[model samples]
Target: MRIYAHRGASKDAPENTLKAFCLAFSQHADGIEFDVYQHENGIIVFHDRTLRRRANAEGYLLETPWSTLQTLDIGDGERIPTLNETLGVVPTNKWCNIEIKHLVDVKRWVNDVKAALSQSQIAIEHVLVSSFNHHWLKAITDLWPEVKIGALSASYELDCTASAKALNAYSVNIALDAVDKTFVQTVLSEGFNVYVYTVDEPKDMEMLAQWGVTGIFTNVPELAKRVMAKRASAKDAVSDKS
Candidate 1:
């Protein structure tokens, strides 16, 4: 299974900062996942409706202007990064998962992403656009038909991966609590890649690998890399014995 840096090695640096993203690649993570919110100025890398958690400020991201939002410190003296800046940091060979946290205009969102990706070395196939609001994903697919999409779900729906099927998504980005071996098998049988979120424990990582998960979004990329490396070595040893 692949390992993605959840909010760019967020456990080490501030979530969604360029510093964290750079660190994730240095840690040899397969991909980086981060949230984006579109504002009057442009698209920005950030998470949460409020700035209280990340910036220790008193304002909602939607209510604040980009000019003001840009001035606040995210962490380690790092300011919030633009979508283009974030994309530029990702190597062409690496992967990126851009989770749409807030978007006011669908067309503007597509246009902005187009511009950013055009400048970055990363290919469209290497980018997985995901959002909990399936409507946004549907609209995005209509505008950019070839762009890969991932369906984000926090709940264990009765339909398993109906949302992903609805969008013809590249993968199903699911919460850790809602996943299990049976569920993974069910989704895999339906031909959808299953990628779990925010998995930081080595035991959970090993279990998911056993269940044949596609990938995991983790806060600690270095630790995930270590766990996966050990798993690979074990598999190689077994293969040699056979």
Candidate 2:
């Protein structure tokens, strides 16, 4: 299974900050995932609707301009990074998952993402656009059919695989709590990838891997890499004995 750093090794650095992203790559994560919100001037990498949570400041992110937002430290002297600025940290060999944190101008954001990828000389196919808003995901697909889309969900009420097929999604990201063998099997059987979000525990990671999950979004990519390595070593030993 591929390991995607959830908001970029978030446990080590401020979530969604450049520091976290750099740390994720340094930790040898297969990919990096970050949230993006469209601002008046440009797109910014952040998670919450307001700055109160991470920035320790009081203001709605949408209401604040880029000039002011960039100055406010989210944590540990880390400032909010623009989408392009964040893209600069990603290597060409790795993938990037960009989650739309809020429902904003879909067209503008899609175009902006494309431009950023182009400017960075990154392959468009290596990027996956994900959002809780199915409409926004669909809009992204409509605009850039080649780009992969991921349907984000926190509940099992909907048949995730069916929804993924309907959206032409490359994958579906569900909360780790909602995952089970049946759900994983059903999604995989439908020919779409299944990615579990925010999985950090070793046991849960092993369980998800045993169930054939396509990828995992975790706050600690280094830990995931270690666990995967150990698992691989154990399997090799068993094979050698056999």
Candidate 3:
């Protein structure tokens, strides 16, 4: 399974900061997942509509100009990074999952992101855009047919197969708590990759791997790597004995 650093090895570094992203890469995560919202000037990396969590400043992000927003120290003097800035710094081989946080301006954000990535010469295959907003995913797929999309869900109210068919999503990201072998089978049966989020426990990672998940978004990529390596070694030993 692919290990994607959730908000860039967020357990060690300030979430959504470039420091976090760089740290994730250093830890050998296959991918990095970061949240994005449209600012007045462009797309910026941040999860909240307000500055309450990461910054000293207070206001809705959309109301604040990019210049003013960039000045605030998210934590440890890490300024909020633009999508372009983050992509530019990250290695081309590493996958980037850009989760769109704003549902209202999803189309605009997708267009801007595509434009920024193209200008930066980053391959589209290296990126997967996702959102909990189904409409946003639909709109994006409609506009850019080739870009891979993932349906984000924290609940099981919607059937995975139906959702994937509806959105034409390459994958589905479900809450870690909601996953099991049956659910994994259901997703895989439909030819869609299943990725679970925010998994930090070693046992849970092992269980998910056994269930045949395609990827995991985690706050601790280093730990995930260690656990996966141990599992691989055990499997190899079993094969040798047989």
lDDT of each: 0.93, 0.89, 0.87
Cα error, residue 64 of model 2, in Å, equals 0.9
| Candidate 1 local lDDT, residue 87 | 96
Tell me the TM-score of each prediction against the true structure. 0.97, 0.97, 0.95
Q: Which runs in model 1 stand beyond 4 Å of their true positions?
A: none
- What digit string (tens of lDDT, one per residue) describes model 3 on residues 146-167? 8888989988755657878898
Model 1 over residues 44-83: C-alpha lDDT tens digits? 9888899999999998988898888889998999998999
Native-vs-model 2 lDDT? 0.89
Q: Write the per-residue lDDT of candidate 2 for residues 65-140, one digit (tens) a residue.
A: 8888879988899999999999998988898999988757778887888888888746887788899888888877
Any residue pairs clashing in model 2, and if so which?
none
The runs of at least 3 residues in candidate 3 whose Cα sits more than 4 Å from the true structure, single-residue gaps closed, are 103-107, 119-121
Stretches of candidate 2 off by over 4 Å are none
| Winner of 2 and 3 under TM-score | 2
